[model samples]
Target: MSLMCDARDIEVNVTWPGGPGTNQRLEKVPSRFAFAFENEDVKGMEEDCWGFGVPPGARSYGWFKLLLDKARKTEYDVEDVAGELTNGLLELPTDMTAKEVVTAYLTKIYNHCMEMLEQRYTANILITTPIDFWLTVPATWQAGAVDDTKAAAGSAGFGTRDGDTLNVITEPEASGIAILTEQAERNPELIKAGDNAMICDLGGGTQDMQILTIKAVKPQVQLEEAVPGQAGKCGSTFIDQQFYQWMEETFGEAFTNLPKTKIGHGSKFMKDWEGVKAAFTGAAPNKQYYVPLPALGQALGATGDHGVASTAYDFMDNAVVLSGEDVERFFEPVVEKAFDLVDQQVSSLRRRKQGSTKLQIICLCGGLGESIYVWKRFNDFCKDRFKGAVKLFTDKQAWSAVVRGAAIRGLNGNTVLSRKAKRAYGIGVHRPFREGIDQEEDSYHCPVGGKRAVGAVAWFIVV
Candidate 1:
């Protein structure tokens, strides 16, 4: 099937806890919001799908526990001592109940997905819902950071970096739950027990590598409960941030001085920053703005400024080119490490003396993995180094693979995790190492003294 479509087809991004709902919706291929509201379409058939991470500070402790425990007996008495001691953690406004927050969170994720899906590509939705619940726990949740003990002890407790900040950290793991559940339900037979598979989830913000062990007869995938730091923050947002910073640095005074209008009561900040950036990046030579160019020029201290002129071309060229380059450089380290991971897995298999010498298939799925530059590098590396052992699976459907997988899992929850596989690989830093953007290899080392060592064994599960 032709996966490429016009970008306008995708209208909105819909996010839910990963599961059959999302998977079914993805398969339906929603290109408009009308599909979501017109029919009682629980699954967003006419919309493009994508997932997002709740700000590290907003995920629910109760939901977090439920996810870690796979919805087991994880609830605690709200009246207990620990609960009373941490009542402040549960003090969100009455209108912002946990459920409301979750729904809104999903909605925001959906909107983000839709915006990205519609930009520079054709699709109904871009799905971030992954089969793996990728999360990162702070290396140490000390007293000042959060009450790790209370959180672990089943209290609805929260922690923070500063005194007033609430640190209900939600890593990528929380985002994947919505998509995985959707996939597990659709393909019970193909995904049956004893099947060992690795999920390569490329999200907008991070890439998650998960190992799933299928049960002997079940359809569920066994997941590790612990957090791992293997994932990197190579999200596309880095590009946006770079662009924003560039704009700020180049035209902060002029841009900020533009008349500001609060929309929907301050929920949305509407200014012409985007217009200015667009006019600069677009092929058009000149674009007019509501705010006169002379005023902006005066603010920018430009010598002969007239009405909105064509200078945006130069501004965009300089800023966009730099941002693109930075995007590539930002991902280089992670790309290098990704190959290193594949090598480690391959080496492990070779040691086992398995009869199958054929290389394991390495699939690429996620926002970061879809980058042309990253994909080219990975494909070239695999082809040159491992011969045919590496396979970079890129289909039109690949971007939404995680959500589809998640949805499939959810529908098949009854049969999920019925299979098992041996988990032997450890995804952790082999040594403490840090290096500047262009530093030499010898410059990489631990900040603290002595030889760098593996910090911790990131979580993995057996099939």
Candidate 2:
């Protein structure tokens, strides 16, 4: 059966099976939400609500999932949440918590998808066919974050209709399903039973890796985890963060003191940077990239130095010139961390196999995985390390791999045989107290049998 799902990073990608004349449909919404309150007492007014890929103003919130993950273990406090908001280009109503902002953002995404579907087909299709939602989350997420995600999805109206369902899977697993399924269909011989492959999903917010061994290829593709997944905050967004830091450092107060309206989410300068970032490949070391800063120019006027003389940067024609070398520097540290994660996973796979087999393939997919430069770096590293023993592959539709895979998994059912747990799961219990082993504070009296015991844990699953 066809299904609807979304893969969320710095943006949310929604995909679903198409109607009679189409194959599939995809929509991308920035993980940004904005609300205009009529007054201090009102919030999320429908007329004042909107979402965009690059939000129109500074009041919108982006990268909120990361914020939620950070605050997962802490108690929710409005003031504390406000402090976290200050770190980013986020502005929220003082009364709203981070979770509330997330819920509103998700709800906006859901409504947008439904509106598209209704326009394509009749609205009656929504009522006749139950839409199952399959969401992808980062492997590094904690239990609290997962639960919160589910709650937000539900609150956003997913799985609320009759016969509808909601399912959540780690991002790496979802990408793996899509990449492996496509590979098996196109070149079955490239992967075989007993072969191992590493799937790296490099999105805007995080890089997640998983190693899986092909269990079977015929009839249907099957896979089992060769090792638990690994992830880090080494994603494309970190590149943006580094670039912003460089801007501040190179320009000094000229950049740092700019008004939010000039440099906020949808400003011309930010929009130009987005294009520059997307096209950067570090292929031309001597080339210079210019990002126009008309607003900054007007603010500083003709006499201002624009801080170019003191640094390696140049300001000409109201544009800031960045060298290819400087842009590559912004990407190196983040890319290195992703490479390290792959190294760790490969090392574990080698130890597990004990030389019986080697990593036969490396699958890269996600928004950042679409980078030519990233692919080149990975290709070079894999060639040197594997010595022509491994094949590096990337999907043509890397940006939507996770969402597409979620749709495929929903239609074909799960092909994974088993998965390794990242952490242990257990229940707390009371065991009969040992005379000297049990601490005095841990001992408890059992009323039913009048027995002394100490609190302990029974682990059902181990990582």
Candidate 3:
């Protein structure tokens, strides 16, 4: 799921990794595909390919994340984008085709995987091997986004050879499947055939929730969406923004006037501050968090750490200190919104099922989903609201759960029987109006056919 490479130049001869040979089949296990790209060769051309992967340089890719944050946005011309990867509505800095970029990312991952495969089995055998790729997508992504992704994958030559196929699923659903699958393996009775669960996937940049219904547990456990998934831009990444702004506001000009270099101390502080956040557990943190700002002295023209010579301003010997309360300022805004989304999901299920215990488990997975603070919050909310009737759980494989769960889907394509529609879908058409059957006021005259029809209404299935 995450590609952490230090940017090493790849070896010419492909070799397998230290693990098992690719030819060996391990039943009920997920495949490992990524090779650590060490920092020496870590920064690469593809790193700048639109912001999905790590950025080559440091200014935050605000626009990229902002674009994905929306469930519906300016639609891209699918054919145009597909035909020419670089051609699209949004401005792109690089001339790399979207497919070229996607393919490059895929190739980087698959090349390592192939090397690992070649280690156990011969490269000749691995060359013709058929592999399934399961990619994760946000539940709220529009069809256009998915279309673009598939087009990119196809351009990347994925699922092209014999027996090769691409598989896609909602991120939250995949995480849920991984957790539920493991639970069933440990305890056969973890979930019955008709049990239901809610999966809250809180990643670094997005929060997604899905309701799953267990279908069967015989040959292998199968599941499907019981209701539409919900998602938003609220994720752990926002906390970094919160912490950053808090520093600027607290220290006034000193923090605000820091150097704007991508590798500056300010940026390094943010990179390190993530650890501080992961350690947060709903507890009042330090009165003043201290950070050694090496970039500060240089930025203000201060020869030494003691003072800024140009402005004759004084400063700490080696660090800038900030209040813990200021660092936490941004957390509640994002957290509360996420809590509300979860509440909506719970309400929908209990309201829909009404009579019986429909939701038995609330599984949290993803980057933020692994947070002790969030896990506790959801657990406490579930216990207080559901009175311990609903269970709260997360997995040790939370970070990679989405990708692994996706692999499970690829292996068992039929695991999900059906998915709930996110919204009503229908087509506009003219129909004969009846006094009792139709609402007279709602009827409209069809200009083409000269027939009566309903205006601005979905005539098909309504969830």
Q: Global lDDT for candidate 3?
A: 0.59
Candidates ranked, most accurate by TM-score first: 2, 3, 1
Across 205-242, the per-residue lDDT of candidate 1 in tens digits comes to 34445433333432233433221213433333333344
Instruction: List the lowest-lDDT window of 10 residues for candidate 1.
Output: 262-271
Q: What is the alpha-carbon lDDT of model 2 when measured against the actual structure?
A: 0.71
Regarding TM-score, does 2 or 3 come out ahead? Answer: 2
**In model 2, what is the error at residue 411, expressed in angstroms?**
1.1
Give lDDT tens digits, candidate 3, residues 81-107.
Answer: 111111122222255443343455456
Assess every candidate by TM-score.
0.39, 0.81, 0.69
Error of 2 at 323 (Å): 1.2
Report, for every candidate in turn, its global Cα lDDT versus the true structure: 0.36, 0.71, 0.59
Q: 1 or 3, which is superior by lDDT?
A: 3
Cα error, candidate 3, residue 317 (Å)? 7.1
